[model samples]
Target: MCRGQTAQKSKRAKPYLDAENAEKMGEHLRSDYRDAVDFGGETGLRPGELCGLHANYVDRERGWMWVREVLVARRRVIRSFPKDEDVRAVPLTPKAIEILDRQLKGRNLTHGCGLEHTDGTECASALVFLSKRGRPMRPDGVGACVRLASKKAEVPAVSLYATRRGFATRAAEGGLDVFALADVMGHGDIRQSREYVQQTPTVRARVIAALGQAPPLTVIHGAAGASLGADRDQQPPSETGIEANENAC
Candidate 1:
């Protein structure tokens, strides 16, 4: 709230769902934006990570992109430049690599998404993601894109970071272990990335199933009444190791 904004977000605004819903919304994006957003969501990249993307960043042969820079902004319009200089390589799923390859082939070589390239220049000006006008996007532009996507998909609000969260969440829900998910999501602090494990569909369903199954537990706990407890115990138990002992009643 301290970025000098006036209007506060509504308290009643719904919570954001992570990657699954975001992936669903990806279908609604305009082709370029769709690739960008979906790639971001799938790969767990931030807006600056997406915007600062360069042609050479993509290693199509290796099926990975070297993420070297990030555009950190004090504010949306007023922005600083890319900060991560060491160049981190992130694996590209086939779809992600395809998006980068196609964008490079299709868009302006001179200025695409606010980036350009020159032969033998100290740094190739090739920006991987660009606005139609060939300018780097402000954070607000990135946010708005997510908003439009959210509206279309009718899911929770998502941001650049949300993509990262979703990347971790979706992977965990899909059955990735903590170490694997952390590697994919690139969290320097394992704790941050590890948190997404709680959001996994497995975890959610377990919580829900546990809640839904609580009545039997209660019946077993309080009711010595044999018929009622037997009836209570008859509710479908999980295929997993969860045990049902009617005698607990």
Candidate 2:
């Protein structure tokens, strides 16, 4: 060890937005934006992935959504693929589907990108979520909205990413396997998914309960009467190292 060097500190996991806090935040959010927050938490989608979701990618009947692209929030550019280039199919819960249905209602599925391009070019875009002005929803805008809502709701301020983390934490506490969680969350590395499953009081209690249900150990002897005549206060032959000599003789 170097005498002048300082030990590196481990990074702390970000606080997750549980259901109670989410409901509080929702109260202060606009109706449309509230749906976005709920949808994000329900599906565990990244902010870019959520903003880039399009009508064509949703399979309402099949209850799945294909994640194939991402919206770079700062630049407002739509990329052809999501982070880590991991295209995936995320299963939607009934609540998630309902949110999507509401957003899709009365919208032009064939409409092009609502935001005006700098080059005056209109590209094909049927984004599932948009601002009240009909422009594409940016990740930064989502974060700002979440922050403002949290402040108004008198809850700890959290970014849009907290919704994704919240989903992961809930899944972990619900006994979802880490490997499956990774796939569902579109994580390229399984270790990233394991961070959400780290030891907590709920997890510890589950472990204790499982241990209590384990079968009791049984001790088998060569014969039922093997030690019947032995001195009750004496140590067993095995413990005294006498059994080895008897077996050798």
lDDT of each: 0.54, 0.69
RMSD of candidates 1 onward, in order:
19.3, 25.1
For 78-190, candidate 1 gives per-residue lDDT tens digits of 12233453345688888787777777776555432232222213543466765554445444455556666666776654554556555666677788888776666656666
Please, what is the TM-score per model?
Answer: 0.63, 0.73
lDDT by residue (135-249, candidate 2, tens digit) is 5665655666777778788776777788888898888878889988998998888888888786433665567668885432421111111111122223232222011112210
Worst 10 residues of 2 by lDDT: 219-228
Top candidate by lDDT? 2
TM-score of 1: 0.63
The true-versus-predicted C-alpha distance at residue 17 of model 1, in Å, is: 5.2
Please give the range of 10 consecutive residues that has the lowest summed lDDT in model 1: 219-228
Q: How many clashes (backbone N, Cα, C below 3 Å) per candidate?
A: 7, 0
